[model samples]
Target: MRFLSSLLLAALIVEQVLGEYGMAHFSDWGNSKGKDYCIFFNSQWARLPQDLSKATRLQTYDLTSSVLCSPSDVPEGGFPNSIPMVMRGNCTFYEKVRLAQINGAKGLLIVSKDRLTPPSGNKSQYEEIGIPVALLSYKDMLDISKTFGEKRQVAMYAPNEPVVDYNMVLIFLMAVGTVALGGYWAGSRDIKKRYMKHKRDDGAEKQDEETVDVTPIMICVFVVMCCSMLVLLYFFYDQLVYMTIATFCLASAVSLYSCLWPFVRRIPFGKCRIPENNLPYCHKRPQVRMLILSAFCIGVSVTWGVFRNEDQWAWILQDALGIAFCLYMLKTIRLPTFKACTLLLVVLFVYDVFFVFITPLLTKSGESIMVEVAAGPSDSSTHEKLPMVLKVPRLNSSPLVLCDRPFSLLGFGDILVPGLLVAYCHRFDILMQTSQIYFLACTIGYGIGLLITFVALTLMQMGQPALLYLVPCTLLTSLAVALWRKELPLFWTGSGFVPPPIIMEQINCTQTPGPSTDEPPSNPEPATSETNNQREDPTPATQEEVPHLTDASNT
Candidate 1:
């Protein structure tokens, strides 16, 4: 159940505990004068006589590079009372640690060029080794060497990694609250649009709330694009990450504008039209308020882009933009039915599993592709993180700083994916006049799924495919509710939400076909009167049929 190695590097030594992997503090000198590093060792791999997990007093060790491999590799002087810094890949952990132990080293420090994994050895081999051995990143090695010479004295101990961070509460609030609010807005807007359909003749208003109904064909294409983009990002991250950043800036600007325009448009003062001109987008002379709002949104997006790397405040901006973007996406893209929701969530469930659990087998680094991309490649030259995720800094102090990402991340996909279903449930509830039963059920399921994801994340210590839990929880909860309510059929196909036009569309096929010529029909008066009578009949539309009429409107 061991997770991928940590992303922590930079001034601290990293140590992995025995049964569960946790961080250990690495410092130079007995007085904590130099940079912070971690002394990462697994008691399971290289057993230590004294419990290093509870280590408090500064146990200083003079570092030496004499024994870089087996005992044969020990230097001529064979310095006593020194911890030999072993180079990885020269030999096995047991041989190297045994060599160091025989050479009078107190402990062994192994420097690696790749991600840190526990030094592995069998029980018999562990019994043969008397000194503790731990893995150190090449970066930490370089920092140690540059700061203190080859023969440097350093103190090492683990301060106990917290079981959970309070930041999880903040993360939960941000995630759940966003989902709830977004779903509420989506449902309320849908109901408002329903009420406004016959009341307003403004095409612009119709266009504003219009959403792209997801089809089975579109679901396949979208998943394919997602898979391709993820792989491309994994392979070309250092270069493509900037492209992602730019895309985020642009998209987030639009999202911000979409989310804010409704409020800003009501300001009334800036309602004057831009002077009519022949410019491409300005030909119709859009409102002055829209222009100002657009500028403000763009500026905010650009500001976030420039300062995204600033861990302190950048995360706040990123979270805000990310939430707005998710809400906008939920409103813009329509799932149409529970079937579409299931299709999307299930496909992504498989996609997430393949990348996180299975891809490691195919990868050279033995690291999950999803984790690698999410955490950023360990060998990335750019050191740029993708802006697609919502970030929050870790609250508790341990070895993490909080690692490469000072903040814990929850991708927008995790929020928006299940969120789409949640929103669908809300719309369904409104359509059925069911008092939000489906909406509440699905949202609670989503919250539970998220908790399970967090619990699994802690237990596995690996980057989990959140959809693995979220999809099933949300989809099943919705399904169960539909079954209980005896509305599964209607919910599945969303027939209960269909617009009035579709019901009459059946009349077209049922009606007789007339002459296919430009000449007017001799009985055109009867046809026109029949249409008027049919339209007049629907005006007394009872409350019972309102649900079907409001199900879906012809675009």
Candidate 2:
């Protein structure tokens, strides 16, 4: 599972980097006869294009001649170029679009000099152009122009919209494959271990067994925590934001201590040992450094999260911090058993589905519970509002400085719920003396599940309960693998199970011993010669019998 976790971490980092730039593609396209046509175009901005329904399938006009050349060089009655320094006969894309808008053309298609080269233009510069414009490959332009010469109207339309990227699909597949492999490897290893243990205790069935029964306690804790979070998110959002910052700080401090403690322990005189108890205490304590650094980071994150209104970098920093905290939890927390992890997932699955899907139906306003809460102001006074959510912003630099609304949002529940299962799987692997396959499997399942949830949200354009997909993928995949390996029986029985009758038989066998000449017997036995003589003479006990009879007569 470590491999899966590492892959997911890598994928996430890639996603973060790519998400910053946003993805672009044509949202809708059609031709002049009202039949939809596919045209390949690159996105210049992350924002959605303005309404283009009326402009669709409009006649295409080529103003490349006048718009491409220098403004001073263009002859009267030719296309007017807006940019002055553009080389003669070389198109300044922005100028061409401006000229097209000025000429009242419904659509403009520019032919690229090279068929393989994508058209480049500043999105902000062309925002006010109003008309639909597209840059076509030289070959496509030629084909269209040929059709136009035949008196058939040629039309082109291009509109950029915010949509999910293809990379997400790749991420999903990678996640699934990684998780399945991990589960299979882990399940195989666990089965081998159990088989070996069974062989070792072949005749001895009364082995001491320890069962872990923390399921109820875990469920209760989960329920309480979830309820508290929901309450805070819905009613006391501002306070929740503050709490989130403080929690991040505390988590950071602990993480710092953990990282530095090992090195601190290695230094001479760094740790002090008591003479009486021989208990070692750290002299070069990390607490002070942890406190100072944590405080500094907390102050910066909070100040940025609260005071820096609409600051993209501030939000990005918060997202980074949140991710770091989640990763730490994933690394530290341990789940007692695979069964417990499955139970937790199943419960959260129902919980997630209800809050995301059913709550909207129940509400009078007909809004998703998560969405409403996420978008709602943290405070009654909007001016003092703080965002409780962790968001990563999409930034655009070309043509203008614009920050697209945060494209990625991560909820605390999303991290903590699956994290518990992953942590549990990690501990299970360690307990079984196996590799980290189980943890990798669980982590991969989580990544794949999250990807599915994101895909659903993108396709449906609505909020989705993540655990609806996550729980089944993570729990069922690993469970099925275990079952296939025939490990389920032993695992379900809490590591090792022995029937009571078999246990009792083994106990009796161990307690009772076979005949041994070297040890004294409970009853005395005569020597071999005496035993033979008694067998030969049927009245061997005559002397003892006469004595007994004489004694009785005397009495």
Candidate 1 clash total?
Answer: 16
- TM-score of every candidate relative to the true structure: 0.75, 0.48
- Per-residue lDDT of model 2, residues 1-555, tens digit only: 232222222112111111112111222123233222333333441122333443323223344454444446434554332211111125555675565456444444555443222234554664565544444444444544454442233333333335654434543443343334333333333333334443322222222222122455757565555645654555665555455444454554443344344344345552322233333332323333334444555565556545546564666555445444444444433344666676766776776667666776776545544554554431233323223334544333221112123345545456556665655454455544447665676677788778778877667645566667778877876676557657675444334222245644564344434466467545434444455565477464343322210021221
Measured with C-alpha atoms, the lDDT of residue 23 in candidate 1 is 36
Model 2, residue 411: displacement in angstroms? 2.0
- The regions of model 2 sitting more than 4 angstroms off are 1-159, 165-214, 238-240, 256-310, 377-390, 395-404, 433-435, 493-555
What is the model-wide C-alpha lDDT for candidate 1? 0.69
lDDT of all the models against the reference? 0.69, 0.45
